[model samples]
Target: MDLDRALSISAAGMAAQSTRLRVVAENLANRDSTGQTPGADPYRRRTVTFTNNMDRALGAPTLRASRIGTEPGAFPERYEPQHPAADERGYVKTPNVNSLMEVMDMREAQRSYGANLSVIETTRGMLMRTIEALRG
Candidate 1:
């Protein structure tokens, strides 16, 4: 593939990974969030889904964020009778976000983004070298 196409592909990958990282960060940030009112649901963990779309201009498939949806998992129940949001059963609904899982997902997304950035940098260097060689 040409250097321009390579850069474009990597850029798309970086964008997708950036979005993933953002979602992961949001999940981590809201991990401890609880409902304000009694018997109300707490913050739900968000998830990102990616898709490969054909870029007509580049004539290549690029990764895109297909959807940002809530996790379909049940929230954990914490027995905190003193809490303001406790239900009649003296249970508070905790967010489904697990800090460990969010941390791992964030790390994975960061590595993927770094890899894509490296690809762009390498392609740029190669293109510059080609130009220099032609001038020489």
Candidate 2:
């Protein structure tokens, strides 16, 4: 039924968004993570890419978490000679992650996930009503 297909699509979307949220959370958690050794690179921000692929069983395009890759940017440097991760020049490399950007991405993912949840709920309700009508 069309309602079944709707549920499938929404479920896929929710799954994708959940993955995105997880990535965002990881970035936020490691925003301050630095390298253990001096002159080593710090933790880089991770990015999630979403793609739509054909679901042979469902015969529909579904959202998928295509890749979780590192963000390409220069890591910010802070002058902290006492830090273990400090370079020879007495500057420590900070993670490339921006807390504000991560938070914004998190908010967007949460909203997308919520919308998918709502669709699933509505589809289930419609299915239940249809079955009830059939019994009557």
The best candidate in terms of lDDT = 2
Candidate 2 regions exceeding 4 Å error are none
lDDT of candidates 1 onward, in order: 0.92, 0.94
- TM-score per candidate, in order? 0.97, 0.97
Residue 135's lDDT in candidate 2: 100
Model 2 local distance difference test score: 0.94
Pairs with backbone N, CA or C atoms under 3 Å apart (clashes), candidate 1: none
Q: Which tens-of-lDDT digit does each residue in 2-118 have in candidate 2?
A: 888899999999999999999999999998899999988988999999999999889899999999999997889999999999988999999999999999999999999999999
Model 2 is weakest, by summed lDDT over 10 consecutive residues, at 1-10
> Candidate 1 versus the native: TM-score?
0.97
Tens digits of per-residue lDDT for model 1 on 1-136?
A: 5778889999999999999999998988889999998888999999999999999989989998899999987789999999999999999999999899999999999999999999988989998899999999
